[model samples]
Target: MAKDISVPFSYTKDGIYYFERRVPRDLQKHYSASKIAYSLRTRSSSVAASRATRAAQQLDEYWYHLRIKGSELPGKHLLRMQQNATKAPGSLLPSEHDDNATVSQSEAVAIYLRLKGQNRPVTFHRAAERACGYVIDVCGDKDLLGYSKADATRFRDAFIERKLTGSSITRIFGTVRSVVNLAASEVGVNITNPFTGVYYDRQSGVIERAPLPADVIKAVQRECMKIDDDLRWLVALISDTGLRLAEAAGLLREDLVVDADIPHVVVREHPWRRLKTCTSARVVPLTGMSL
Candidate 1:
């Protein structure tokens, strides 16, 4: 005997209906079945019920088809329907819009992830996330994808007032621009790229001064020698080689190359590894002091 499910629809303005279904516990994780249920809740009753019936039928047709093919249906069809309902001509019938009025913020984030994929680096992703958070905090449930140029300008002013550095401001604005661009493309909203004409003051560049003066270096070295011989060697290595503090800290025992004819240190992908450019990867010839 085939199991029966009860789907409920509620009536409201314009004679439209909203739906809910009593799904079987055993099929809770079934992609097609869950998708159908999710669809029914957002679509107009007649359409929702029809799609639900089709999805349920498809579920029984072939297990692999339902699992693999059905997963695509929710993202493509259901999400599209929800997007349409939001921008549908005229106000959606109360029942039609009730459960589908605003796209969930989580949905926006999911779309952002799909847009970013693996194309963006971790730093870019982090910056985008920070911008998204600011948008959500300021706009609440409002759709940031639909924000106007004026809105973006307001955000920029607010960010500046918070005393963020020019570089930091640029990074945050860049993230906002990417999210808005992707959101506009995916959600069919026309949004202005806030960072398009924006400019931040670039402060005078400061040169990185070498670590300590000779007197301070000697004093520190003398202090280190009295405390621990290992620390003394570490201080000597940095003072002699001009390696960055982090690179020195992260150096491993295996990174020490004592057999080279020129006796240079090999920094090829070491624990303390930051090369300014491809040209920075060459060996640094050791002096008698470094040895």
Candidate 2:
């Protein structure tokens, strides 16, 4: 039998935990969320619990604020400008209903860019902005809390219209969602993310990278043998050892264990370049033209 799975503010599926809730219909207009099925973005239940607890705290405060305001908060649940003159003598003011921070999608993207800028490359930041730009274009500007499943659906349809592959579309959605989620969590914004469950069509549209044909490799090798430059050696090295373009370009003379019992190329980080991942740092056995 399947494991009996239950938690106070979360649920598990496929080894990942998700925060789930059904926003009361009367309160949905104010929160701008119908249902919350946000992935805590973790496989570990403990981590998911921590994240879910934070989300739940925010939601609880929202519910409390709603009850405190009673029926005074007006029209389509929009917070109207203060009308002190029209108010009952001792009624609670609109100011009292200011329960959460309100950030527009544009403003959130700016914050995301600023916070992410120092750590990541400019190209990465630019790509993130483009991804966010597409979202704002499709969804229209709204407060963070105002994003909904309808917006996600619209964005998905728009991407499909553009003929973007499922992987590309999913990546665009996921990037913006990640930015929003991080910003909301870090900046103490109380919002339910619509993009969490709006992932792209899975796996099918992923185009796998294939290796060069043996004849093509041979043709390149024959040509590289004629050129007497670093390009020639790079072509030769990859042709035989299959080293990544960066790994070959970033190589140092010391990284070549040519004198060892079994010659190898040590794919390690250098002052000029770092391995993309820890696993990228390894010893690749050398042979053929690479020797």
Candidate 3:
């Protein structure tokens, strides 16, 4: 047998050619072994080289797909049903007597929004829509009951491929689970949400923020008090009350209650801005240079 540069495999003394390639680090978890190895069963170098080239090309295409499975699909939202201004809850769901009916991923999004989006902010609706849209983009709009645990795992892997922060992916999964759960219950279908229990590293690639040290905060506050200008006032206010930048920036004039026994600023939802969480809507007493 002649040595062929085109042959990317090893050979044994018995003249059997074998193919072996290491699995990429990111995709290692999908396989039980670190490397894929197989016997080509060809003693002819020409045949072995041809076989190796084809196998390598196939693997390249597969790995490329795996890396970009979560990429945004153009016009994925088109798959969704158009919103009905007067549709009642469960209107979009399949009929109770229609045992043959199946709810698709798009229908689930519409059903969830119609039922849960009442009086909710636009962000709420968009979040649900975007999350479900990802499913349709990556896995097609399959019937709700058609999803298996493997599909859920694939969805998770797609998010990883997209480089979404763990927290962001977790929120996406939460929204998807809610949509599927609501759709299943409203349609009187007995099905479990496939998005549940799909584990991804919740803190992977997350850079934790550390709070400012007491001395640093004090120094900054001291500088703010010395300047006491409009710009510094904003910084001082945040330093004292710990209000988020948006929360403080969007505060209403009426939110300031200086005449009260304990002067405080009301942090509540506004049309221009919404509280980060329900508990974020509260009153914080003004103190230090904030007064």
Candidate 4:
């Protein structure tokens, strides 16, 4: 018989439905609240189910952004929803606005940073600044809607004058254009995306770095076997796991699961470290010497 999994994340108390969920054990440290509970404020089972579903989904988003920002709520509505669950759950979305086009270049950069920089690497934030700074310098202080194709062409030419290669210029344009796009989509900024259809030379400054040879891997493994220290384990782990050096180095005992049917390593954010991206957060099954 199929098991009953109905209404998985809700319960009733005194005829009122309440939503609840436990924090994942690994992420417990990141949450000030271990178990989240809020009154869904409905008596009907159907209504409770719908509200609970939204509340549950929002809880996932809250947890996700919490992990992304290392304990900070990504937007005010997320906190508002948490604190006031009696309100409709789907109302937790970021406040909608139609004023993005009017936002100046400098202000747009600030908004972009506010959206992305909470837990990102310092270098990531700095890269955005450098990319946007070049544009602001070339285009002068202007609203995003006011930035013309001529300004974009000038920005491109300025990079050319600096002797920057096509690939580098492409990266800068991509970064700044992403900011414009994000503002347009999120803040209702009226824009045709001035940077669109603008092409540049992308042939130069491309470098190739290939994987190590099999013999080099074999030699490293042999050397790892000869030593019995953490460094040796680090070398062996990196060789076989195909994990980033920092990811492997940051693993705590709690992150390793050896006795499961499939042994795996959990890549997660910690107080001391943040995953490079959400896609970087994953479970890699143990294999070969990694097991």
Candidate 5:
């Protein structure tokens, strides 16, 4: 019955919890309303808290997409002119009159999502939309077949001009390529995906993550023990088990195999939380406080 202070929720007469958040001043022009309010539809505090967190995260991602869409890509003018020059003689941009030429890039994104987005995480849909949106912003949304290797090269170059890390640029190309490939296959079109095999330095401007020193980890664990609160318990759990924050948080009580020969925890995807990688699902041995 205690209120969760981390998530902002208000109660109604019926004990239903709801949340309201004000849209930031800069992003207000994108919405007709100034705030977002929605019912969590649950009286239980825990359920309401979870729902509130999810809602806030989704809104943040949506706002991020809007900002990305509104901002001009670096070197966009030069990229657009180059794309126009490289187009084939009869190729048409996706204009009001070009609906029947072929499946446009934006349409390809839609088709890709509709076919492959079922039960996928929100990031899956966003990645496709963001990548295709980048291309559209730089080179104009043309027919799927209209994009040549030159266009793909230009897209990569635009990201470079934007100072995005090489890995980030490669991931964008991966999403764009998948969308184009799936759409072309579904429509029985024989067009090659120009986004494929676009070369970029995958390590340029990348900073590798350094693990915490052993002494630091041990000191943190000691401090966690001294604090001995729910949050510290979670930290200790992660420290010993090497589980990601979301992975450990999403674990069910039954996921711990304490009575087995080797005490361990099973990490897997849940309806509320998805693993970052396909191979992320594994059994991690527990030690120290996690045991």
Candidate 6:
């Protein structure tokens, strides 16, 4: 004996036939099977049945695609239904997934703004906006969340072809990856970040030290002598004491102390301005000169 197979079906009040498997569960709440069948019956019983059946199939396909893409159910079914009714023949409905399914370049920018509102830094948001814009410019009408590996690879190649600096390219790619990860979480979609495996070249670090030859030191000292005596003293204090320029500049008259037993300076806050560093406020021995 053969096993029995049961396929769901819907019927109109006027006795028109339609398939139930095609109708999405989300749509069934607002649009009853009988109502859809009756609406089709007004045209022609046979034609109505076919139309209802096709509509059901379309809904099924849309839901299937959303499932494959790992997207969540849209918040509003009636709005989605209206959009579906107006779509061109063979065109997918926008409500099959979230509004973020196939985002416009402008919409991508809006996503960045939302991230910024959550306390993301301005630089991160700006870079994400730019990367998404570039992706949209290259791949028109394609869902970024559902982009294939080939698409991601091609986009990486395109960026490289533009001859942008490696660091700049890396920053943009990093921003895109972060945005996509965040969007995926928000929409309940699981997508492979395009920038996951991409790497950028790093430039060598070079150190430039100031020259300190004896002849150069003599020339600098001669130049310092041409200035006022007070300025010359400041220069000498910095050179001998290894004090930072700001610390030397912050010294005050009261800070200069002269006692036979302990000849040292006592730096204090001057005119309500504190020293740049705690070390700058300490007393130091006056070995070579008197105050």
Which residue pairs collide in model 1, if any?
A: none
How many residue pairs clash in each candidate at the backbone level?
0, 0, 0, 1, 0, 1
Ranking by TM-score: 3, 5, 2, 4, 1, 6
Candidate 3 C-alpha error for residue 263, in Å: 2.2
Query: How much RMSD separates candidate 2 from the native structure?
Result: 18.3
TM-score of each: 0.46, 0.60, 0.66, 0.59, 0.65, 0.36
Tell me each candidate's RMSD, in Å, in order.
15.2, 18.3, 14.2, 20.4, 16.1, 22.9
- lDDT to native, each model: 0.51, 0.68, 0.76, 0.69, 0.72, 0.51
**lDDT, candidate 3, 120-223, per-residue tens:** 88789779878886786567678899999998999999889868899999999999999899888888888877899999999988999999998999999899
Model 1, 1-291: lDDT tens per residue? 111233333222333333334334544443334533222223255554564455455434434443555422222112221333334422212234344333333345446655564545555545555566565444432445445566666767766676676766777777666656665556554555654776556342324567577888777766766776776788777777876655666667666777888776765555335544446555666664466
Q: Write the per-residue lDDT of candidate 4 for residues 76-153, one digit (tens) a residue.
A: 111211333343422322355533335556556656666666667878776776777667556764668888888888
Native-referenced Cα lDDT, model 4? 0.69
Candidates 1 and 3, the one with greater TM-score: 3
lDDT per residue for candidate 5 within 1-291, as digits (tens), equals: 334465564444367676667778987655546776555556777777776776667567656765886521111111111122344422322334544456777667766766788779878876877788778756666778888999989989988987899989978888888888887776666777788888888999999999999899999999998999989989999997789999988988898899999999999888888998899999999888788
Indicate the TM-score of model 4.
Answer: 0.59
Give the lDDT of residue 151 in candidate 6: 63
Clashing pairs in 6: 22-56
Residue 139, model 6: Cα distance from true site in angstroms: 2.6
lDDT of 5: 0.72
Candidate 1 residue 195 Cα shift, in angstroms, is 2.0
List ranges where model 1 is wrong by over 4 Å.
1-127, 139-145, 178-192, 204-211, 229-232, 268-282, 287-291
